[model samples]
Target: MHAFVVGVAHYPYVGKGLGTGPARRLLDDLGQVTVPEPSAREIAEWLLTAPRQPDDPPIGTVEVLISAPHPVKVRASGGAPVEVESAVHENFRAAFRRWLRRCEASRDNVAIFYFCGHGWRHGDQLLLLEDLGEDPELVLANSVDLGVLRARMHLTGPRLQAYFVDACREVPMDLTLSGSRPRALVDVPEPDGPLHPVDAPVFFSTAMGHSAFGDGGAATPYTEGVIAALEGLGACRKGGQWAVTTSSLAAHLQNIIDWNQVGEGNQEVRIEGQWAGRGVLHSLAGAPMVPFRIGCSPPGTPLPERVTARAMISPSPVSSVQVFEANQGHLSAGFYEIDVAYPPDSRFTGDTILWQIDPPNEVLSLTVRSRLPDRS
Candidate 1:
């Protein structure tokens, strides 16, 4: 069985006063990112279940986590030096290692981890911020090392380790430091591996070397696409390993329309014995218990009659739905009789009909289908 887990750290306060915008955005939209213990069990059950297809595995498990959505963790050291150009001296923080510790209680056939937020590089070493500290020495990127993170994880049997990084800076690691203790950066050997499709002999782990960019019109595009891919694996094609191909993942995420560009694959990073591939991430992107609602104001456009018009009435669907100009078609579904505008759209003529359903990938399909005369 495969298991995935997550821990997050955040930094809310930047240079000045506290604001609600950034954190509030995460209120309902915080995607399920952590792999809990029960979730891990369930995943294993999925892989072991009788195969619906003789060639397919019946059960599988995956875990994911995203933290500090409500608030990026912040802390201050008693006497840390502050830049004179800086407006606010506040520092936010998150308990990533602690949460990771819980996730790593026991490793599986395959495990993946992801860390976002701020990172600094000193020499070849990379450091993720825990919180603010007065001691300037604590800020050194070398203080943390990838090998240390690997040792802290509870990888029991034979398994692959794939580390991904977005943090950009490099820092020197003092081999003498406690977390600096070096371990082999390779896969773990689990004697229990089933050798069948159930066991993921090939697993990839990723860490963004430098992903400190601020959230904007778009959240983390890479992360967003990654989550969508994991959430909709049924929509993906399977190679040897379970993967959501990059093109489809990008298309799913593109629906949000906030991102300007979408990246494809990670090249150059090497994992021992694992084939190099793009569009694959080792982080666990788990499904949420409930559907998350995301609401945003439409981009520069004339005010529609209703607030949810853009979401409710697609641009293309209105054309095939023709109604007498005077006797506008009425929908039996909701209290609000949405005022249908003309020109690009057709009016309804037949008995008022409305199906409470989500729009398909191409709203134009509905219009095209409606234009054809009734087959009956």
Candidate 2:
């Protein structure tokens, strides 16, 4: 599994430098904070959370981080200068190296990469906004070319590939309260197929097109969203690969802040041989990867995965009720390995009905706190 980031804020940015401004913005966005200052409570909330995406069962070993934060400082809509410094790329590179070392543990065994600079979208094509774009400093794609990306994912083994983006187009726009919300999706069309045998899963902080907002000090919406959805959720264990639905986490982020960037949808790749449709799951060890079938039932949940059970007892005067733990993300009716049984809750305590589970051991019970809360 790997994590890649590309942040661009300022360049030739009123001649302020190169990468510092956007670097801060990237950090703040991943950190979910704003410049000059951010909320303390948000910081605390993000700090306590952990990475919730399941990526375990060791697929060989190679973690990479690409940092491209080219500061192209310019005033946002409010005449406020965005802080982007070229030197910040060096800082992020060092941070990424350290991060790679900390996660991979074996220095000699890890694959590491970091880049930061300016990027621009020319029609459907995404290009770097580096000084070289004008035929001078030699600009390269800050967001690597799909051709290069394919070459890279092939090396990621057939396991999983995870992605995180905190980038927003360096364009200008005005915010309208009553205005239509930015479409949650921004798509860059593929030449043909989306199925990539080397592709596993991807998790992004924000959608494309939209600008991501973060106070100077907090994590950006993307990182903040990851932290919030994963923290204390008790979904992960040591050495396990986890696949989360983009929609579920996207919904969670809606309640946090108004994330500026609206990312494009999934991009599958092309392949050949009998393994043509094979995705990155080919390299996933232990359990076989279940491909997501549109409109059809998805793969079943692994037996080892812990399930989050949400139930409703129908607060009405009914004496009997059913406890349903929705399959939601890929878990199914057949996956409930735990034998859930209930005796009955004939007693109502303080306008509340206490429901009970069986075996004198089932821990789930409904409180009379005004019938059971229905998490519809």
Candidate 3:
């Protein structure tokens, strides 16, 4: 497999003192933040080092392009001024084109593309690059169109291609939020004929036109969720084997972003593809760890008669507390949920609940709080 990761943290013309103050103000109003360059490094490192299936071949090459303002003091005749350095703006296109050519010849490997940056959607997703557009006019000349790239990748016959984007598609001054949720779905022409063979799966950090927030000291919420899923935080077993696939990873990421208050439901992750079965990305090498999913109201949130909950346990969960038994006959094995309705007068007193599993028995504790008396 081949992996290419791009992270852009500094835009020359979109921010402070660049003759485009309005653009910066709009970005701030829309909740845009500078993406951390370490995110690119971390993702590339994982792609290079993540455990692959036991029989899968090693990744041939991992390419990374971190686009950020690395200050370099340049001495001039009058004085010294600082210049920003970036390789993505200088060589990324040529390097990627070369790789695309190679893909035409090879035709049988997996490919991964990850981009974390500022972007806008105008008929297509446009990745903002380093070039300084006409200030105030703000023509997006130095940008990459995601749709065009996807179409190009379709021509290259790789077994699988995966794309991850962490960017807001909202254009400045574009207040309309109608049709803001970005969808990666592809429509079919007919009902049952042979569909187009575009074996690419994509994951977007935010719904259409929404901003993807960045953490000050950590990776963006989206990348953090991806890292957690890849690290087996929410892994599930299938057919007695511990593994992470595109489907499972997507589900885990969505659950994390939605249930953990990661982005308060603003930064929703969406995954789209058409693979018949789960596409395995990594295999847990005999690690005796039980992966499970849990979701409910936070500890202090109001308690309802019917608190909805869902779970997926790998390697068989022994038992559960404050919940029902696992239905072994489920079409999708290892999946369980809690939909029990409590009596109207039932008394509850506790700060937490427990979920216990075995083999390497571990208990997961979830804090809870009853609804406070109504204040007049």
Candidate 4:
């Protein structure tokens, strides 16, 4: 697999805090961010250290670019840390070309692209590079038109392509009134031959006209959710093996965002383009562990101090038991018989709850009902 990743956090010309300059004055309304650089580095680390099955493709090349106040370094598997390039327009274009060339070496290769930074929506998504607004006359000279880039990717050799855009889709007021659109950094001629058969899936961090969020000096919530999904949370039993497919990953991301309340409660991830339903992004050696919530029905029923929850694998002796802490825990994917026990003197009674712990649906809620009093 080949990957190209970019994170632009130091937009000297677009935001405040930097020295007063012509470029900064032209686009000082936008705010500066501190999350994209870390987010990009985290994604690159995962790509380098991600586990793969025997049949999976090995990591080929990873080209990363980050725009930050200081030099950024990343380490590959079994290698020393290396400095990455700045996410300037020239650097990004060069890195992209190199990544595309590497991916073109084989049609079976998987191509991945990720970008996190300030972005705007003007009929299409426009990703701002580090040098955005440097040219006062052409404010978008250093930006990329995401839609055009995706269309050009159709002419690439790789059949499976995944794109993650972790940026805002909010429309800039100036651009909205001016009706100006940004041009892509790179342009490709129309293909004379028929376009290649490509399954390109684009994952946007937020819905149209929405802004993505991140904690200052830390990775964004979207990036954290994505890494978690890629690491196994998105895997599902497919053809007798656990695999993380496009659909499963999407579902898992949404679940994580909602369950964790990662962003502003209204932020929603959006998926676009044609997805290969069975395209396996990652294959796991074993079943995925999923989080589960256990509670008694008839909400807030009083229970004894000594309560135990045991989850036994169906048709097998293998089981895991937690004493009182089973109200919330992680369980491996499978059909399980859950037994919750309460003290004899407690109003709540023990009950058996059957549950199917599945992947993608990482969080499962199981409710045990209390046995009624013996009126007879």
Candidate 5:
């Protein structure tokens, strides 16, 4: 497997004094971000240390380009930490070429691409690099045209390719009015030979004209979802083993994201392309631990101060009980007898609910209602 990751957090001409005159003003609204660099680092670390199945090919290389306010260092597999290249157009082109060459060496290789940073939509998705407005006349000279890149990837040898784009897809008015389009790094020519059949799935963080959300000093919400999906949350029992396929991963991502929202506006995840077959991204050695959520119904129902929730596995050799006071918890795939208790002083009652937790990242909201006294 070969992975290419790009994270741009520092745009020199966005809000800085890198470019003079009108070109810099065009990017006034696109400010510096603090999440993409860390998000990319986390993904790279996971790829370096993640366990691989016996039948799966080993990870050949993880190429990362990060643009940050200060120099950044990353640790490769079994090696000392080294400084990574900046996410400028030249560096990205060079690094991507190297990564693509490695993927072309083996037909059984898997190619993964992840990008997190400022982006715009103008008929095609434009991924901005560090030196976006470096040239006064050509503001988008350093951006990348993602649409062309996906089409050009068909020439590669890797049959399985996945792309995770964690950026906004809002259309910029300036680009549309000025009739400027971003340029693709690779020049794709008409195919002459039989193109290798590919199963490439592109996952976008948001829908068109929507902006992706992220907190300062933390990874973006979409990045967190992707990592969780990779860590067995997206796996499901298929044929005798647990595997995370393209379809299952997409479903789990939406479920997990919806469950995590707390009064925040919904972010619709958009997925493009389809798998040629069942594209298994990751396979687990055992049953996956599914996430379960429990809450009261009727929008803002009050609960007792001393409420307790317990889940006991059924038909098990040994008695096992998991207790929690929060509304969310993780449990291994099994049939469970859930019991909730409330304080006598409170006007709420408890009930025993039966649940079957089998799906990956399964989110269930167990609602306990209040018992009303009879007038009679």
Candidate 6:
């Protein structure tokens, strides 16, 4: 698998104090857990040396680009020091694009993109890059759009693609600006050509319009859970090796954050896109349990106002209740019918819905068919 990883704690032009103090301070204290550097480093480490059963296919050439500032100093023979300026937007963007080129050359491989930094989602998701001094208001231009990035990477035709974003999508409300909000440097262009369907699973630390917590003085709960899960902990053992699909890992990651009460309010982690049956992320040794499959239909069915759908839980008796939106209903030992009512104002056209089952931390994918006649 090839990886492009970035973690940023500072932006030179965006005034040192941009967002919430507590949150910023958490990141500043590198040793205090919620720091971005450690999280980025650990995640890259795991991907580089992914643990697998001896019988499983050996991992292929793993390439990575990590852009987080480390305190390590490098001295040159001529007395000049070599410093890594990772946060610069232009520098990081070049590195990211280079990684994409390498990935394109190796089509038959798994690709992963991990970004942990100060970011906010607008139009698409943006990862703030360190750039030469530019207007603070034009931060968007210096940033990279995750949606566009995903599309470009999808063109490489990797067997599997995974994106992990660990950043706060919160806007800095207290900032003094010349206008209501800043505009993106490059106007987000209309898709003039065919759009590639994103089949990879994307994971976020928190839901929309919320913040993710790092280190209450330890490894931020989100990254810690991910590391533990990837390390073969809490995974179901299958055929002498631990079994964990990408979907199952998503549920497990969510459970870890929720159980630990990581973030404030409803800091639910979200998993989007599709993962085939037990989309095997990696298999190692852990607790022995078979990962169950959760299925929904008519797959990408559309809804007008109210719709009835079926959810089938394999191996039966998974959970007492199924959760969607804010409502919950009891599930029998097997399949159960669910009635969903979409609000009139809810703009769910071409959107993925997150369905969860407690006790058995399982996730099912369901899509809201687009309403536009052409989209249908």
- Candidate with top lDDT is 5
Taking the tens digit of each residue's C-alpha lDDT, what string does model 5 give over 218-282?
A: 88888888888877877777788888777778777876676577568688889886466367788
Model 4 Cα lDDT, one tens digit per residue, 190-284: 88987867778899999888889788899988898898788788776788898888878877788876666734576689998767756777889
Q: Point to the candidate with the largest TM-score.
A: 4
- Rank the candidate models, highest lDDT first: 5, 4, 3, 6, 1, 2
Residue 152 miss distance in model 3 (angstroms) = 0.5
Task: Point out the higher-scoring one by lDDT: 5 or 6.
Answer: 5
Cα lDDT over the full model 6: 0.54
Residue lDDT tens for model 3, 1-376:
7776777776655534433344435333432245547666668667766667765545776656666666322222244432323534445576566556655456567677888877877776777655534243343445676776776667554756778888877755532222122222222223254434645778888777777767674577778767766666445676677666676676667765554463465667766654533666666664434333433346544333443334446765445423423311112222344343434554442333323342211223334445465589
Model 1 lDDT, full chain set: 0.30
User: Which of candidates 3 and 6 reaches a greater TM-score?
Assistant: 3
Candidate 4 residue runs with Cα over 4 Å from true position? 16-26, 176-184, 262-264, 302-316, 319-326, 343-345, 361-376
Q: After superposing candidate 2, which stretches have Cα over 4 Å from the reference? A: 1-55, 58-119, 123-143, 146-151, 154-156, 170-207, 232-350, 353-376
Candidate 3 least-lDDT 10 residues: 326-335
- 1 against 6, candidate with superior lDDT: 6
lDDT at position 293, candidate 2? 12
Ranking of candidates on TM-score, top first = 4, 5, 3, 6, 2, 1
What does candidate 6's lDDT look like per residue over 161-238, in tens digits? 778888776554322232223323223445677654444888888766667677532445678767765654335545
Against the correct fold, how does model 5 do in TM-score? 0.87
Segments in model 3 whose C-alpha atoms lie over 4 Å from true places: 16-33, 71-90, 132-138, 172-196, 238-240, 258-265, 273-277, 287-376
Better of 1 and 5 by lDDT: 5
Encode model 1's per-residue lDDT on 1-376: one tens digit a residue: 2333322333332223222332222122222222221222222233233123333221243333333433221112333422211101121112323334434444432344444433443333333333212122332221244444444343432233333333334232332231322122234455464332111112112222422322342334434433433444213334543333333333343342232232533322212223223333222232211121211123322222221211134434433232223321222121121233323344221222233422112111111112334579
User: Can you write out model 2's per-residue Cα lDDT over 28-49, one digit (the tens) per residue?
Assistant: 2222112212222232222222
TM-score of each: 0.35, 0.36, 0.64, 0.89, 0.87, 0.59
Error (Å) of candidate 2 at residue 260 is 14
Candidate 4 contains a number of clashing pairs equal to 0
lDDT to native, each model: 0.30, 0.29, 0.56, 0.78, 0.78, 0.54
* Clash pairs (backbone) in predicted model 4: none
